[model samples]
Target: MSSVGDLGKVKRVETDVVKCKSCGGTMVFDPATQSLKCEHCGNTEVLSRDTNVLERDILEGFEKAARFDRGEQASFKCSNCGAVVMLGADESAAVCPFCSTPIIVKEEYFGGLKPQVILPFKFSADAASDFAKRWAKRRLFAPRKFKKTLSPENMHGVYEPAFTFDSKTRSTYRGRVGDRHTRVVGSGKNRHTETYIVYRNVSGTFDKFFDDVLVANNSNFDQKKLSSLLPFALNEQCVYEKKFLSGYMSEVYQKDVKDGWTDAKKIIDANLYSAIKSTLHCDVVDYLDISTEHSDVKYKYILLPVYFSNYRYNKKDYNLMINGSNGKTSGKTPISPWRVLFAVLIGVALLALFIYLYSFAE
Candidate 1:
């Protein structure tokens, strides 16, 4: 949890206001129309979709210190949850998506790098909450009340930071590969087929192009749960526009570009290995060594939309994430202890019945 002293040092940055052309009321991005909608006048302003989203040179990014904060935000420290989040300057007080604690906006945390592209939300909070309820219904061990009482008010739309790396790789690899084969080594009564691996030295040059391999840069959320929200329509991303961020909050990238590259390289290496193995067409690889040279490496800092909700059950917090682009949901829910106990009792009864049958047979 954040200390009162820590919160005292925080300051708020003024945000640019987007007003409705008709009523002059505050306007927010409406996902359904892909435009800015006025809360008071019910008017909508269409944002241009002519996005020229570009990838920056990876080597160039390495030459500079990578920053995560974009200066257009106000910082808030959640005293109850210890979550430091950036909210739009206009948003004075908001709830922490991680622990559902109210946070008071204060200072600017850091002047971070601006995202190159954004995938805006396609669904509303009510839709995301409905998806969550339907998803909860599918869990056999979930409590019934959880499904009945899950509310849309608990879910909020937030933008998550990620890095998408594109690269053209050339690799030279050498390895010993083996193919399994069987042969009869004995005759007559002693005849038996023995399996042997036929090994051969292999060397090859492999080239592959990797596009938009995404790696999340946030440490606050569950990595596996975040991954389950994938297959985002990343191709439909738009150039960074403040209009898109009217009402939503975004996470500052915690992993720097260099560290992000390291993660991207790990993904590339695995893909390279698969490509090399496919070229060799070997049943088993004994040992493989590869040296890769990457050229035309490009990366883009991107924001993906998600509807986030956190719930606490049995003194533990569970997170639910809905893909803002497609409404696909993933989350952790509370398990019913009574259901688990009943399952254990039934298992014991089955075991006892099997033992009684075995005794009669004996």
Candidate 2:
């Protein structure tokens, strides 16, 4: 993470390239176990972390996002895998999909907008495949052949883009809350009586400050899927530096700053309302009428690491993802009913054999 030249104190980079000397396969970020793993063949390498970093004004980052042009994955060679590649308008692949090597070469000027901070990948490709296997093993209904055929080579490490926002807000709210209690009334057969009381004339000003609310700067990744890759260690974030992008392919922030900020505000408002409503100290939660206004909104654009894999089973394809920083794994795997049945049958056979042996001994 040491600063070099114009990258200043805010830039962080992997000092050494993770390579598999045996196969020369580029090491990729793996979400499971948080390590640098070579997927072509099972190999793991050590990576050190330097947490010194900086923060950006979330709003300004968004404004710049407005002036930026959408960048395409033009002809470029991968530093990790040595692939001279081209991609569709939507794709932002970091490595060569065929060779399983990192291929994304840094652009001198990637659409004019530069990343403010980065979440360097800690996990390697081999670890990501292991994560996939562990994840696959739990799928009781998944196909056995597909499980065995699950290839780690199908996975790629892509740098997903996002904008984190910080803001101060004040909201005016009016809401109703209710609590239920029952009373027993009656004969030999017990009957329950329910009572209702309404809350009215509720109004208050809710003010809360948000430090880091996330917004997807890229449209490709699903919010649910993207959110699975959390705990970005924003504390380790540094200012915009090109060195970090040297050997990795990065995605341009597709969603403009306005959209990102709006998204961030929405997330913040939802949490803020929940906080305010809970702070009201009501036993039951209900009808909420709240309006929020944003002030002093700030933001940062970042490239976070992830291991992505796609597999086909039963004519359907599944995408699996792992968090590059901490190895938190998420993705759908094919289920096999045969495997489940076989496992159950084996258990039953073992029990029967044990009983027969006991009888013979007697």
Q: Backbone clashes in each candidate structure, one number apiece?
A: 6, 22
Off by over 4 Å in 1: 1-7, 66-112, 185-191, 221-225, 341-362
For all predicted structures, in order, the TM-scores are 0.80, 0.72
Clashing pairs in 1: 10-107, 11-106, 11-107, 12-106, 68-112, 69-112
Worst 10 residues of 2 by lDDT: 1-10
| Candidate 1 C-alpha lDDT tens digits along 49-119 | 75788999988778655553444444555554556655653343344567654332332434445667989
Q: Listing every candidate in turn, what is its Cα RMSD in Å to the true structure after a full C-alpha superposition? A: 5.5, 9.4
How well does model 1 score by local distance difference test?
A: 0.76
The superposed Cα distance between candidate 2 and the true structure at residue 62, in angstroms, equals 4.8
How far residue 216's Cα lies from its native spot in candidate 2, in Å, is 1.6
Top-lDDT structure, candidate number: 1
Give the CA lDDT, 0 to 100, for residue 257 in model 1: 81
